[model samples]
Each structure stands twice: as C-alpha cells, then as structure tokens.
Target chain A: MSEELDTGFFADWLRAAATAIDREAAHLTELDSPIGDADHGSNLQRGFTAVQTALAKEPQETPGALLLFTGRQLISTVGGASGPLYGTLLRRTGKALGDAAAVPLPELAAALRGAADAVAQLGGAAPGDATMLDALYPALDALDAGSAPGDAFPAAARAAAEGAEATVPMQARKGRASYLGERSVGHEDPGAASTALLFEALATAYGEGA
Target chain B: MAGGEQVGIVLVSHSSEVADSAAQLARELGGGEAAPVVGAGGAAGGGTGTSSERIAEAAHAVDSGAGVALLADLGSAVLTVKSLLAEGDQLPEPARLVDAPLVEGAIAAAVTASGGADLDAVAAAAEEAYQYRKV
Candidate 1:
C-alpha cells in the first residue's frame, strides 16, 4: 500500500466524518444547549451532508481539490461559527496540500497543524478557551509525535477525544459561550466534541486503509 | 462622491432585520450615491446565523472595483467574511475585514465610502468607530 493518501482516502475520510457527525449530532447539540446556541449538531450535519452531496455530484481529482470543495460546502451550508471555523480549517489545509494527488504522513501532519493554527487565528481563541482548539491542538500534538503517517491518525483521535472531555472544566473566552462567563464551566464544549469526531473519522478512514 | 470610485461596504450579521436596518441607517447617514452597501445576513432558512454564500453574493453585488470593506456583528460573521476573502481568485482585490462595532462601524465606513475614499481609508474609518464614546 502507498505511504501517502490519495483522493479516494480523502473521500472516505469525509464520508466517515459525515456519518460520525450524523450519529453524534444530537449529543453535540445537547452539549451546546448549555453554553452555546444548541445547534452544533444540526449545523455540522447540514454542512457535512452538503459536502457529501457535492462530492457525489462532482468527484474531485486531487485530495486538495476534494478538501477545498468540502470546505466550501461547509462554509456555505452551515450557518454558525463552526461552519467558518471548520471550513477555514479544511480549506487552509487543502491549500497547504497544494494540488497533491497523494500526501505523505508528514505533509498531512504539517497541513493539519496549519489548518488548526488558521482556525485559532480566525477565531482568536487560544487553548483553554473551551473551543475546538482544545481538541484540535492536542490532536495536532499527537500527530506531530507520531513517527509514521499510519501511526498518527489513531493517536490523534485518542488525544482529541481526551481533549474534548478536558473542555468540560474550562471557561470559554471566545464565541457566544464566552458571554456566559463563569457559567460556561461544567459543560463540555460542543466545538471540541465535534472536532473529536473529525479526528475519529480520520482514524477510521486510515485504519481501514491499513 | 467628487473623487475616484467609492469603496463598497458589506454588513454581516446573524439577523436579517439587523443587517437590513443597519444598512439602511448607514446609507442614510452617507446620503444618496453612497457607495453601494449590501446586507448579507441570516442563515438560508433565516433565524440567527450567518451564510457565507449570502456574504459572497453580497460582496459581488457591492464590488465596484474600488474594493470592499466588511463589518460583521459577531464571531461567525467575521469568520465567514474572512473565509470568503481567503478564496484567492473568487473575491476582488483590496478587500479587507475591519474589527469594529458593527452598527457604528458600518455607518462610519459607509460615510467614508460615499466620499469615494480608498479601501484603506474606509477600513480605517470603520476601525476608528471603535473609539467613539458617548459618555
């Protein structure tokens, strides 16, 4: 098997993400009800559904194209902070991938780091702000620690899940949740939960490849 | 209006009514022939969210080649506009995102654009609105 992932792998990864988000949408929204607008689950579901439909309608030739199109779909379909934040993550990562048909593990990791950083920059939310960065940064760290491309996804997924759980005690410093001040504590961050789902989807897709 | 082409302004908000009213007020403040102001607000089906597609359409609608200055209500609105601008070839050049209070910033930006101010000047005017104090 190739050491790098092609467009097919990218497609599978998105499909897995959509399915996982669909299954967990209610849980995500439930988490949001306390601190956020209570629409994280439905917003992501709509965005990912649009992504799925777009990919099915017009298959992209390269992984970069696939991710870029997916990001656009999310941005247009989802109507919240997550849409732009996640869309920027995917779009920036895709742009960093630079038209590559297949991306090596190291390149993918670097791309993901760039994507996460872009999300942070766009939202102006740092670690401990009770946002997706809590999960995303840990996932990136785990990926960075992985010596092989195949080793990264599973580790990242595990780290992301733990990170999402970690957000429960944090106080939001950005977004609508921030308006709650101290009241935001005790609730798991919906963004972090959705981000964990994304990593989980990545792990599932890569595990299948292995 | 007596100078070069006016910069365009796009107001992004989660509520369609807020965006529309804000735009109307800004237009009135800038007088007739103010640079075109477009309101891109609300989700596809409406009710409290921002649509990037709507934002893109608004941007295109307001683009007069002088450039565009964007004012957003909240976090997601800002992020969406930034994402749209990040699309390399899709949006016009000289586009910029101003970090400022939405209503005030839009009004300030509209007045500046109406005078045919350049992109930077219009953006600076919007940003300066953050310093306005009534007390």
Candidate 2:
C-alpha cells in the first residue's frame, strides 16, 4: 500500500479523483441543465476519461508528470469555459511540482497555491463568483492556513463544499451560466460541484493513502 | 446473457475516439493477457457507426456462446447497441450508462470485465466505484 505522501499514492489519488468525476458527471450535468449548456457532466466526463486513458497507457513516472498530463488532457478534450480553467489549474500545479521525483508537504502546498492562482488567472473570477474558483480558492486558502496534510485536506474539502453551496445565492459572473444573469442565481454551479468532489476525494485520500 | 460463456465487454461512446479512449483504459487496467475488453462506438452520430455492430458481431462470431457487456455513452448510441444486440437474439449483459466521468466508468468496467468476472458483477463494481466523496 502506498502512504499518503508516497509517490505511488499520488498516482492512486489521481485515479481516485478520476473515478469520483466519472460518478458525478451526470449529476453535474443535471445541475447545469437548467442554467447552462446542460453538458457540464459530459464535458468533464470526457476530459477526465481522456486523462484516465492517457495515464493508463503511459503511466506517468512522477507526480508532476501525472498532474501535467492530466491537465493537458483536460485542455485538449474538454471544451467550454471549464476546460481551460481546470486545465490551467492542473498545468500550473504540475509546473509547480517542478522536477522533483516526489513532493513533500511544503512543495505540495506551494503547488496547490500555484494551481489556485492559475485558476484565477484563467477564469478572471474571484472567491465569490459561483464558479469552480469559488470552491478551489477557499480550499487553497484553507490549505495555506497551515494544518497537517491530513487535517488540511478535510478542511479544504469542507471549504469547497461550502463554497459550492454558496453559489446558490450569488449571481453568475462567468461561464455560460453568466449568460443567464438572474436565472443562474438559484442553480448550483457544475464546475463548483466537480471542484468539491476533487477536494472530497483528497480528504478521503488522507486516510486511504496516509 | 450471451449464452452463458466467454463474454466481451462492449463500450459505446459519442465518438470513435472517445470509445477508443475507454478501450485504452480497459486494456491497461483489466486485460493482462487472457481476457480482452471488447469495445464499440459511434462516429459523430450515435446510430451511424459500423464499429458498434462490427465489434459485437466479431465477439459473437468468435464465440457465439459468450456473454457480452454493453456500455453506452449517451444519445442514439444506446439505440444502436440495442438494435445490434437484438439482431443477435442476444440481450445485452446488465449494461451501464456512464455519461459523466465517462472515462472512469469505462475504465472501471473494462478492468472488471477483463478481471474474469460476469458482466453484472463488473457493471456493479463500475457503478459503485464512481461515488464522489468529500473525504
């Protein structure tokens, strides 16, 4: 079994995250149907599916490569606003991982911060935009606040969930949902939902891998 | 039930490329050597692709008594699979519809399919394995 901090476990974590996305893709689409293109789930499903396929074929040698390849898959396979935003997040984080064979806690934290910043750069949205950034931003904030990796993950997960829920009342400021104006206010953001799942998978991984 | 013998897992997707991606994952995770994950997908339109029927026919032709699992992406691809299977007088194995996380479900299904288990078992595992968690 791989430890939470082990290089092997990072691969497992990415696979697990892929699984979670697969499971929730339709639900996310359902949430978006009312306010957006109704393809959020499908879009993400396709992207992550590509990531899984690519990773399986080549099997990245390092955690950084895993994140980089996964991010590239999303950018290529997925269309719409979510693709680039999510793509930048992973790519930037992968870049942050540098050339290290394995990442320590501090490096991982820095990578996450890099990911969050990249997301903001790509999406041009802040913490309250009811986008994936909403959940991801808070999660990174929580992570940066400094707790054990085990403790920080759960906190980040919780923050993400809250951020997703917070989208319920805010006006959409970006993405297809933004086109809806007030109509988008009541609907949950699909990107945010998937974002929440990423954190959730992370939280669960603390024990499974840790 | 594929006549209760060696079964092939059928994968359908909106595009041939997407379906192939699913096949790639299965090949990696499941089929080590002995068993292979059978795959099919529509090109562009759901029902138009010959790949879906050809793959199923190939599987049946190889071993008529074998069971084949059907996994469809969404849209008309499902109907195409149904028509192809109906012609063979072979009802699809307990099938799964995976729209979101398309790759994950396909990979999981392929892994289990090639793991030497029945279609029902593979589908169940694939479906259950997709649950999103918050830790």
Candidate 3:
C-alpha cells in the first residue's frame, strides 16, 4: 500500500469499526453494566452505523473531510458523553489533517496523538484513569516505537488490547465508574475495551490492502 | 455586553421531560415568559443521553444577544456542555456553563435573567443557589 492514506482507506476502517462494534455490542454493554451506564455498546453501535449510512450517501473527498463528517455524525446521533468525546477524537484528528488529499502515516500518528490529548483534556482523565486513554495511549505509543506500518499496526492493536485488559484491576478515577469507588475495581473499563476495538479495526483496515 | 436585555437560559437534562419540567417550574417562579427559556434534553432520537446538537440549538434559540447561560443535570449533561464550550463557535458566543444544581440553578437563573440581569449576574444567581439551605 502507499505511504499516504486517502479518504477511502479511512472509510474502510470506519466501516470495519462499525461491523466490529455490531458484533461485539453485547460484550461492550456487559462490560459497561458493571461500572458504567451499560449503554456504551448500543451508543457506539448506533453511532458507527450512522456513520456508515452517512458515508454511503455523501462520501467525503479528503481524509480530513471524511473524519470531520464522521465526527459530526457521531456527535449528533450517539447522545451522552460518549458522543461528544468520540466526536472530538475524530474531529480533532481530522482537523489536523488540514484538507490534505492523502495523509502520510507519520501525519496520522501525530494526529492520533493530538486526538488522544484532546480526549484526555475533554474528559479530565489520563492513561491510568481507566478510561479509553488506557487503550489509546498504549496503541499510539506502540505505533510510535515500531519501524514498519505493518508491524506497527499489529503491535498497536496488541498494545491496545493489553491496555484494556490492564484496566480490569485499576480503581476508577474518572467518569461514572469513579462514583463506585472501590467497587469499580475488577471490572474492565468499557471505554478502554472499545478503544482496543478501534485499534483492531484500524489493523484490519490496513491488512485488507488497496 | 448588554445588561438591559434579559439573559437567555437553556436547561440540559438526561430526559426531555426532566429539562422541560425544570424550565416550566423555573418559568413560574421567573414571572412568566420574561426571558427566553429553552429546554434541550435527551438524545437526538429521544430517550436517555445528552445531545450536544440539541443543547447547542437550544442555546442558540434562546440567545438574545445578551448571552446564554446553560444549566445541566447529572454527569454527561455537564460534560456535553463543556465539550461544546471547548469546541469553539459551537455555542453562542459568550455562552457559559454555570456550575449549579439543575432545578435550583435553573430557578435562580431564570429569575435573575427575567429581571434583565446580565449574563454574569444570571450565572452568579445560578451558582449562588447551590449555597441555599434545603434543610
């Protein structure tokens, strides 16, 4: 594949994300049932499906445009805090692309970093807080440390998975789970789990090849 | 900037009924339709969830150039309003997320805005409501 990614590549990744979210919606909801509102799965599934539908109707021309459009859809459709948080993630990353026709992998890396930072700032949490940052930060860290895109993606996916798993034992420090105090431990964070899924979807998208 | 014009109020809640009811009650206490008061509640498709789009729309609708003050209930409601504020240009210019209780804050904010208070004064009234003794 080319070093630079186009709108089609991201659209593919988002479609893969939607499918994966649908398949794993039950598990996501179950994870949330323990420490969250138990609506993460449904909300994300609905948001991604909306993205899929919108992408089909009016395909965005550039990578930034596609992500920006997707972000707005999620913000409008998903509802709840997840909507704004996820929307900001995509929109911030997309905005960093700056209407480039195709974005290089390095650019994507930087964008994801900015996106994660934006999420942290917006959510008022950090990597160990057991939010999506747990998965996202690790994935980006792995991506930055790797040499090849292929190796980086699988590594990132693995790192995200491990990060999500690590959250199981962490005491919640933010969001609704924090309200649970000590009881929040032992349950894997649903947002972290979903972040892992997002990385997995990215890996799958890259593996499909143009 | 304009103090003579009443500040607008937008009540955000997890449920449509909750926000509307608060707005209704606050209106009664606020001298009946003295200022623009809007209830932006629930997800876009209805049901549970705080819709940023809905809140933004409500804020814009109630805005009278005097500035809009937002009061939200519960977790996501506060987060959503903050997210909108961070996004820049989404909310009406000079909009503020007032830190206060949902019902009580809305009541105080509405009363203050209805009396033609400026945006800061309206927000202050809402925040001050938290200090009232319920017992």
Candidate 4:
C-alpha cells in the first residue's frame, strides 16, 4: 500500500484479469444470454488471453506502457462493445499515467476515475445506466475513501461486487442490454458482472505484489 | 474538398459478409464512380464481432485527404468505430462515425461523397438518411 505499483504490478494485474476472465467466462455468457448477444464472456476471455500472451512475449518498460499495450491488445482482439469500451478505459488510464516507472495506488485510482469518466462520455452512459460504469464508479469511490490504505483493494472489490448485483433490479439504458427495454430488468448486467471480476482481479493482484 | 475524388466510405458490420455487401450496395448505387468503399467486419480471429483493427485499416485504405465517413451495423459495431475515432491515429485527417441506419445511410453517404462532398457533408448526408421512410 505504501509502495508504488510498477510494471510488474500492472503485468500481474492483467494476468490475474486473464485468469479470472477465463474462469468466469461461461457465467458471463449466461448473464448475457438474456439481454445481450451472449458473447461477453467469450469476448473478454479471448481478449485477456491475448493480453497475457503479449505480456509473456514483450515486456513494457513502465506501468503506462504495459497498460497501453494491454489496452491495444484488448481493442484489437476482443470483438463487440467491450473491445472499445474496456480498451478506452485501459488505454486512457495508461495514457494518463504518462510513461511512469511506477504509480502510487491513489494515483492509479485517480487515473482510472478519469478514464472511467472518458468511457462514460464515449458510451453516453451515466452511473445508473446498468453498465460497467455501475461497478467501476462504486469501486473507485470506495478505493480511497478510508484511512487504511491497505484496506482499499478489498473494499473496492466488495463495492464492485455489490454494484454489480445492484444492476439486477435496474433496467438497462446502455449497451446491447438496452435494446431489451423494460425486459432488461431482473437480470444482472453482464458488463457490470465482468467489471466486478476486474476489481477482484485488481485486489488479488495487488495483494500478490503486482 | 471539391477535387471530385470523393471522400472515402467505410461500412462496418458484425459479419464480414454483411459489411462487404453493404459496401458493394453503396458502390452499386454510386454507379461505380463513388469514393473508395471498404468493409470492416468481424473480430481478428474470424468470428462475429466488430474489430477496430479492421475498421482502422478500412478507414486508412479509403482515405484520400478528403476524410472518411464510417457507418456501422449495430451495437458494438458503432462503439468500435467510435473508439477508433477517439484514438486519433492519423486516420485521414478526419474520420467520423455517423449516427444513422447502416444500409440507407451508407448509400446516401456514398452518393454524396462521390459528388466530392466534404467530411461534414458526407456525415450530414448519412445522418439525413435517418429521416428517410420507406414503410
């Protein structure tokens, strides 16, 4: 918590993301089947695997470069809206990190906040839109709110999970789910569910010294 | 933008076949003298999804200094194009994602751009198709 997250840390985070995405891919697809095209899990699984492969092949010198590379990989490999949406989140956050060798946790969270805002703008979505932003916002909001810096990741992970579950009762107003209109209610948004997994990966990676 | 070479046109779809068909239709409507038209479709690994790489390539392929007008089939397709545009990757000085129906908008944009329309005109032409009704 006191140290900055370096390239290795970012690498570990993405690797965890890849593993988590693979583990939960089927569940994600199940969530999407009702409201979306039922491709979220497969799409993210492929994208994160590509990121994992890229990390193994070429090492980026800094956290920024690593995240940028990961973002580009996701954008190119993952199809559908998640490609661009998640791509923008990572790429923009990486860009904001600005070639730094390491970033403190608070700074990383701040960069993500800004990037999440950019994603919201790109998607024309707000907090209640039943999208990834639902999970992202609450998690980021919880990440730096307390005195115990070491507690941040766990708190964020829980907040993200809760945020995702909160989407179950809300009608989607963004992404493929929105096409279902009122019928979108009563199901967890796949994007939000995946977003919870992302935060969980981040927490685990940070705990593992990523 | 009046050199008459035409602004480039790109049709994006989840399936390669649909994207290609849309481009072909737009070109046919232009009487074969329209701007460079291309299809950007499918994920990199050959599946049903939108690819920014394909989109960026098509935009690059058709760009002739007059900018490019891009149309997308649905959900993720539109988002993919928007992300590419936001990347600002030297994409023909200007590449725009027009908000309009894919097929109708592509034809209208193709014809207008083939007439040496500027980027704004091409995009507006595409959006104008939103008002078109054939019911």
Off by over 4 Å in 1: B1-4
Instruction: Report iRMS values in order.
Output: 0.8, 13.9, 1.6, 1.3
lDDT of each: 0.89, 0.67, 0.88, 0.87
TM-score against native, each model: 0.95, 0.59, 0.94, 0.95
Between candidates 1 and 2, which one is better according to lDDT?
1
lDDT by residue (A1-210, candidate 3, tens digit) is: 786788888988999899889999999999999788889999999899999999889989999999988988887788867788888899999999988999877788899999989989888888788889999999999989877667788899999999999999999998889999999999999888998998999889989974
Q: Which runs in model 4 stand beyond 4 Å of their true positions?
A: B1-4
RMSD from true fold, candidate 2 = 17.1
Worst 10-residue lDDT window, candidate 2 chain A: A1-10
- Angstrom error of the Cα, residue B101, model 4: value is 1.6
What docking tier does model 3 reach?
medium
lDDT of 4 by residue, B1-135 (tens): 546667899999999999999899898896556778889887777878888778888988998888888899887898888877777773667788888888899989988887787889989989999998889
In model 2, state the lDDT of residue B91: 41
Candidate 1, residues A29-112: lDDT per residue as tens digits? 999898888889999999999899888889999999888888888988999989889998998889899998899888988998
Cα lDDT for residue A170, candidate 3: 95
| Cα DockQ of the candidate 3 complex | 0.69
Q: How many angstroms is residue B88 displaced in model 2 relative to the true structure, after the best TM-score fit?
A: 50
Q: In order, what DockQ does each candidate have?
A: 0.83, 0.02, 0.69, 0.77
DockQ pick, better of 2 and 4 = 4
